[model samples]
Target chain A: MSVSALSRPSFSRRALLILLSVLLIALVVGMEQLAPLFRALFPDQDPAMYERESFLNLTLAHLALVLVSSLISVSVGVAAGLFVTRPAGREFEPLVSTLAAIGQTFPPAAVLAIVVPVAGFGFIPTLVALVLYGLLPVVQNTVAGLGTVPSQTLEAARGNGMSAWQILWRIELPLAMRVIIAGVRVSVIINIGTATIGSTVGAKTLGTPIIAGLVGNNLPYVIQGAILVGLLAIVTDLAFERLERRFSFGESGAMA
Target chain B: MSASHNPTRDTASARLVANRVLVTLLCAGLLAAWLLPFATMSPNRLASGQTVGLSEALSAWQAIALLALSAVLAVAALRRPLPRELAHGVVLLASLGLLLITLYSLGDYAQRTLVEKSPSARVSQGSAFWVMAFCCALAAIDAFQRASSGWLLRLGYMLIAGGSVAMLFASGHFDDLSIMREYANIRDNFSDQFITHLVLVGSALGPALLIGVPLGLLAHRHVRLQGTLFSVLNFFQTIPSIALFALLVAPLSALGNAFPLLGEWGIKGIGAAPAIIALVMYALLPVVRNTYAGLKGVPPATVEAARGMGMTARQVLWRVEIPLALPVMLSGLRIVTVQAIGLTVVAALIGAGGLGAFIFQGLGQYAIDLVLLGAIPTIVLAVIADFTLQMLVVLSKPAGTRR
Candidate 1:
């Protein structure tokens, strides 16, 4: 709120982190656009691309997989997180966190293979696995991020006669949004890569080109997918950092 | 502690209705999905008379034993008065066993298997084994846990509750490797394959961490280079190890072509060399990110105090910052290590070798037993690696920090 606070040394850190990020982003775009150059240099190589599917559809399908699965995961996971966090259900928090961790460590691709028979191939099966895979970070982060909200703030909200829902919506969630975002950042980035395996079961996404390239042994296609995902991850991370700084206490002990 | 665990003291019928029913339903849903082979796998596939070998049967038994052991410990954790020592011992043993198991499995699987199955088989099977192994592993870890120990012990209770779930699913297990082999159309050689799977996954992690840590440190220090380098590494990570390998294949093959020395070192386009490079490259982002985050997280005050007291920047950093930053750094390493173990399974896609070979091999031929040989151990390796690294992070945390 104060001008002096806004002008702290951290502003310089922010600028530096941003400037480098822009440079890297430019490098990634340059790489994508200059593929023809690489193709020429490596004369034996075929240019990387999809034959049947347009890149737009593939990108949309990829986004849908992430959005739908993450939405489902976050809805249930956050509900579970909020439920376990409350007085009536706080005791079950441990049970919930363990299940989440197990879900996380559970191999999504392997599960995808097994689930293919029951769920059938393509989007649904991959959706199921992605939902399961994405659940932990969201749920665990929700619980943790909320739990770390200052006790005084929560109590004050409760004392003001805020309904439990109101308290959650108005108080805890806003405070915890930074960590929740962090978890989302992690889940999103991981999903960016993990989604590539979806192609194995016939789920179309950017991963399809990469896997097709891998199977067909085409380097440029693989590079294209890798480069896209890498850029997506970097961009999301920087966005999250900016959001965290905007939303979070500027210095919450700076160490812990 | 036993006082807190009075499940018997609670209104028994109410507890059953409120908790047990939901868990049962959840388990049933999960099991119904997992047991398609029993419920819907083709009889024609079954009629081919695929048989389970005695070895595989024994291996499944071993898996059961480990699961049962975890169950017993869970029960004990809930009811009896466990001395602090045994609980602490469980944590230590679980931590150590996970590491040792992976290391041993890696060595075994790394050396080519007689069956021509590669290392991914081991990684996949390792993950499955640990799902049970570390569930029990974490379950029994009632000691030395702060925030999570309660959950760990509660997991023990959940595992105890799983008895009912395990009972419902018991028939599924009863069918044995022979039936699975017959239906899936594969050989029975169950136990050895599972064991081999375990070894491959367990061992791959050592190499991942071995290479990941120093590079992480380098990224942490070179802040100026962080942007390009981190993005490249992150790119490597995001591509998935399988695709990364495809990209690497031509380059590796080219190198192998140009330099005879590279060829002699098994550094060709396919197989282990490409696999390792891809895995290592995939490893860099997490390691580096964690290192940078950890190093950056050192308290400004602490550093300032150290420098104010007449220490060089280097000295102050080594003494004041690193020790404090360790917990977060190790946490990052923990994630990367477990991830590496899991990804190694997929590396089999590129002929990188691990437990995935068995899973893929089974998928290729529809062999359930071989799939189990791969899938189970990969899961086991996942559990073990996860818990072991988790324990390390916990141990490294400031005394009394919960979790």
Candidate 2:
């Protein structure tokens, strides 16, 4: 909302950060070249690390998994929430709430354990678990958002001859947009973190290095993998925060 | 679209409709249980199991009894002007009974089937049994919500139900099942892992509170610092638990090398040290956020009044701010304790020696029972921690203060 913040930074300044990050990532992916540096540090452990797949590929794969699962979770969670809030599906509110609560309370690791047998290993089971893990926030936010929509506003919409669907879309949803976005933010961020566990099931992600390091007692691999993952999480979170702020400000601007 | 919507009637009718749907779900879930396999019979633990449906495993009379009970619950759920308390009580009792009966009957069936068989044979409950258990839990929670009861009372009910099952379990009623067999095999190790899990959580909490409270107070005092502090903590939160664990190893190991005595004291890379460090890092956000929020929530007018009375800042903080903020702060502790309990299981992968050792071992062997031996207790621990901490938060609230 700050005018100074809205006045975007100069292109060169923005590009500097972007380029610096890119160069850093390049250095990491080509980290095998830095074996001497690693050897000087780790000394005892294997300095020449062999990550079969490139970090770029792993990062992309990890992000893709997060994206697909987050999308599914948001869609299903929001739809389920909307359905239960409707008169016909209202009875299902507690049932749906309980199901989501159980899904969340059950650790993602445990979910992986239970799901692996029926669904088999790799992406499907991991996706299933992540989606389930991600559902609670979206559903909770949707319910809270819809539940708090002022009755007077709904009545006004009805008085203006809007249909139920129209009121929900044009009035209720727009009003609840910020809350819904908050839910999606939470869900997606959670999926990003939880997705790291998918490496145990052999869905190659940034966790490959970390798991490999953990098993081999190779701290260098672990540090490299963890830094990338941690950075990704930070960058993604900041992006989401910026997106949320933009939406909030845009809505305020429209209102003004 | 009706303008003349009578809120009370609408809500009551909605409740009736919801009740009907829940009963339908219960009945359908029961039918699924009947149609699907109730347990699997494997020639050995490592062998692919054959499905044993309910009818194949249980007698016709047992099936009839279950069906009859299901019908009773369905009928009870549908009655007009539902007796909320009575219905809830019935639902609770019936669920507890059903779960016990199911477990006992399965144990009995396994014993009958395998008494003369090879020692390697394994009998495990199938997906149907799990689904039925889930449905029972769902229904009981729904009923519990409908019931107007205090936290202590609800907890007492849970204890009674849980304790009864534990008693039955201790009586060797479920020993024939593969899960219990696995538990029996590792009972001593199980206790040690449980203690280790508790210690990990307890140790993490001490440091978390020590650092988190001061950090929270600092952030609270300086508005500019709060944003950067929380963003850093939030960034820490978004890093996956395992990643955080992995990250801590290198630095911790270096520190250990620099200080021989610290290594002697178990401050190393691979074991509980890194695990506890990661947990403490993960815990700081909630504890800090909650502390800050709690302090921020104190009525400015009250603080003003205290200052007007010539109280020093520290005096106001200790005498006024703390008592007012204690409940919220405790709630934050509740969140972290529950979270830390669950996260500690992951710590076992690094030889931290918690329930996760069983879980990972089970995963390696593809033994679901062994996994359950660990996973179930972990869940139970988290739930108990959450419930107990929640009660503490409630109790700590000043008398007569509205929650």
Candidate 1 Cα deviation (angstroms), residue B342: 0.8
Calculate the i-RMS of every candidate, to one decimal place: 5.7, 4.2
Worst 10 residues of 2 chain B by lDDT: B1-10
lDDT, candidate 2, B220-315, per-residue tens: 898767655876787778888888888888888888999999999999888999999899999999999889889999999999999999999999
- Native interface contacts retained, candidate 1: 0.24
Clash pairs, candidate 2, are: A91-B18
User: How well is each residue in A141-176 modelled by candidate 1, as lDDT tens digits?
Assistant: 999999898878867877788787898898889889
lDDT score, candidate 1: 0.60
Question: What does TM-score give for chain A of every model?
Answer: 0.81, 0.83
CAPRI rating of model 2: acceptable
DockQ of each: 0.27, 0.44
State TM-scores per candidate: 0.66, 0.92
lDDT of each: 0.60, 0.79
